[model samples]
Target: MSVPAVETAPLLNTPLYDLHLRLGARMVPFAGYAMPVQYPAGLLKEHLHTRAAAGLFDVSHMGQVALRAADVTEAARALEALVPADILGLKPGRQRYGLLTDARGGILDDLMVANLGDRLVLVVNAANKAADLAHLRAGLPDSVAVEELPRALLALQGPGAEAALARLAPEVAAMRFMDARVFDILGAACLVTRSGYTGEDGFEISTPEDAAAPIAEALLADPAVLPIGLGARDSLRLEAGLCLHGSDIDTTTSPVEAGLGWAISPARRRGGARPGGFPGAERILAEMEAGPARRRVGLLPEGRVPVRAGAALFAEGGETAIGHVTSGGFGPSLGAPVAMGYLPAGLAASGTRVFAEVRGQRLAAAVAPLPFVPAGFKRG
Candidate 1:
């Protein structure tokens, strides 16, 4: 479905607001809309539930756009020129996550692009939608049509997500991570993808805006699927070692520095030797080989005091500032405080002792391996 030309508020309201409220969701402002931060079940319960079963999330505010041309080959080249990912090698029905670079090669936004049977579908951060669309429209050839899907996106994430989705569409069971298809889900024609920001085995369903509520209701009817608010979503993704846009990464950062070098394909890296594709290509390519000055690293706080974003990470004596926390919270699954931040490369090794200055006191912390919780993504 084509998106309506309606002007949306910075705080856009999702079709599930009423249902979220009915379920006693704690509403908060996010991405220009009032959204549930947590449901009555609280963040702890919701976090655990999603890790153990299925957690339904309303992520419709995310921008869903399609770029189409007469042929997939032309479309792929145009996209590959803008993103570092191996878009040209993407098979039909498979998706790849990548970053949009500024002329200088700094990351503008992290996005997911899929080779739909006929076109390329892009899912981007809601906060960067307008700019992202403008960037694509400007860079893509005139022949390509950039259409934003008028749909409400839902995510059924966790270990039990497959079982919950199969109750409605058994075909979902066969999809591997990052594979998407237009399928009938709960009687509604929707796009279902086996992917999510959370590193769990899950599916993101994009239903026609109006049919969203009904499909969401149907999914929740199953005892295994519970409403998950943004709070839990943030925590879950953090535990999964996923970066949050605008925080962990932004225009000032490059994918290599953000620990997203895997997103760049060998073709792009080799292309860098010639140095002429997108913004920041020169610097980004150089960093790919020499390494970033500062890198995003995971930190495990020693005590229960949850270190919040913006907390300062200090060197041994807690005098020299080494890094700043970007995303931090209580990892319900890990049963401890976990955080991700950018630190000088010299201080980013595992087991390196660091201190986080929380309010007034210094809390002991250590450089830790990411995905504090194991990722359950379907590899095959």
Candidate 2:
């Protein structure tokens, strides 16, 4: 019997669609949106430019939500029930990484939670936005209001980000990593966060949809800034060793095993103020203390060939599979192929040798320290 073709929803366009075309970007469907995957400069050039200079990315497809309540603390506590984070302890004008966990302790999505004084704003992956909205509405009390923001988000990333941004809003020069502040850009209010997926010093700016194009144009006018697309964005994040929710992590992966235990706040851990309340707390806490059966680790392939996702990993010269590649690709920054995968804790140590099955060949790979490139965040 002929297999039936699966129907797909029509792709949506972000506010910068026209600008992307003007800049000769190759549009591709991602997360139900038509986003630019690369520009005329090609993926290699874009990736390197972002590392050496500022690269502006149109990330308007990301989900931005505002959680409001008469008392911000009340909303924080309400959100804390669904995530293993200490939202109550998150101070205003700051943002923290968080994971939405399932009842089984698997990750639902990874998000950035920022305290914007009057409310908590979350930036979640675009693919999970609908589910995240429904999740908040179902879990939060009536007192908490879950409102989606119609905003266009842009990321200006690289070692040169601050200088380029400071030209528009001079105050951004003083903002350190993870610091969130509100500023006006060319008469439009924009929420600026000193954070990004790339392990570089940068800012994610949330601006009104109507003003996005003008602000992007202003920044692009700077010689240091180039209009980057999703292709470079992915390779950049891969080099940084940051997990992509559906790939490096998923519904079956726990935060502890994903090398994200650091996202769990000390206040929410065992013996802390409020413990064992969040979803999957029992399994997650147990994994935190005893460690998981497998852990996420970085891998370096022996040759120039890439060991992509889904490649089964094996012990050196062994037949049985021990793990699988979660995410993998060439590292433009390192001039080599790099990958990340889950492996038994005993074999997860750096320098440990393993073999990845590719094209009927068993290629040797070595476990390496994460973040093929060093982080450039201005953490104080």
Candidate 3:
């Protein structure tokens, strides 16, 4: 995902900023907000702890918008005009992931759409929220209203997330992946989704800004939950083979090239009932059928040396470049260095050997299946 640069201007703080500081977090500027990069426990420990238990993340930096029309059908149809996803098919109380694409098929941002019974709630990247809102207003029918929610979002993620959250809200225990519901926790009303970026069984909670800190503290009070920061958050998502908007995908990168075709529902594809009306449909659909020139793939470096983003990749023994790493680092869960980048389609298959040029030296690497660590989502 495209992380906004740390600008020279003043930075904003989330509702949990004081709580993070109190917990001994190291704060840094991210996407115009002063965010916690890590706490006293460090990224490595935070990563492992989340996998074994639960991790509480302050994601108030994300944008939340409520899209309402005459009804759910109208709202979904209006949204479908901007994205390739089959929003109309999204059942109430469930969510689906999608990308906002420009006319040229390049990604503007990726987002999650949750059907909230009366209205559709969209959670978009903080950096692109403003643009995304404008895009929605311009493309959607006037009957559909786009209102940004002044809410704070938090992510409670990991294998123990369900249990930990259950302690406060038992109803959350029955929520499956992508399920959404409104419940009261610590006297605060929240829209909680059984979804997260960690590729784990988790929930993303949206609550009023005023109540965010209290709810977060309540969750952290559980033994299974610990505060995590952006550092571990990045490493965790990278290990799950999840793309970061600005780094792995951007306005120059199409969904097909990013290996996110799964986000395009069958109903939006050619020959389906609602085929190809969204932006860049022609080019995107063509690429989907003919295949993209370059495809994102997982890279496993041969040794201990970590290949970071922007590292050049070359064909075995050939100096000419084929692709570049978009996200890379040591995966705490895998206990090895893992990276993901784009490569020519033919060179993207698992077991395909490539070389990464690091520090003027070429190191052997292999194209491996994505999610170096298997995803633990509770799909059932």
Which of the two candidates, 1 or 3, achieves a greater TM-score against the reference? Answer: 3
Against the true structure, candidate 3 has what lDDT? Answer: 0.94
Clashes of each: 12, 0, 6
**Superposed Cα deviation of residue 364, candidate 3 (Å):** 1.1
Question: What lDDT score goes with residue 174 in model 1?
Answer: 93
**Model 1 Cα lDDT, one tens digit per residue, 254-278:** 8889999888777677644323476
lDDT of 3 by residue, 190-242 (tens): 99999999888899999999999888988888988999999999999999999
Q: Evaluate residue 274 in candidate 2 and report its C-alpha lDDT on the 0 to 100 scale.
A: 91
Per-prediction TM-score, please? Answer: 0.95, 0.98, 0.97
What TM-score would candidate 1 get against the native? 0.95
Residue 214 miss distance in model 3 (angstroms): 1.1
Worst 10 residues of 1 by lDDT: 270-279
Per-residue error (Å), model 3, residue 217? 1.0
**Once model 3 is optimally superposed onto the true structure by TM-score, how far is the C-alpha of residue 301 displaced, in angstroms?**
0.5
lDDT of 3 at 38: 100
Candidate 3 lDDT for residue 23:
99
Give the least accurate 10-residue stretch of model 2, judged by summed lDDT.
263-272
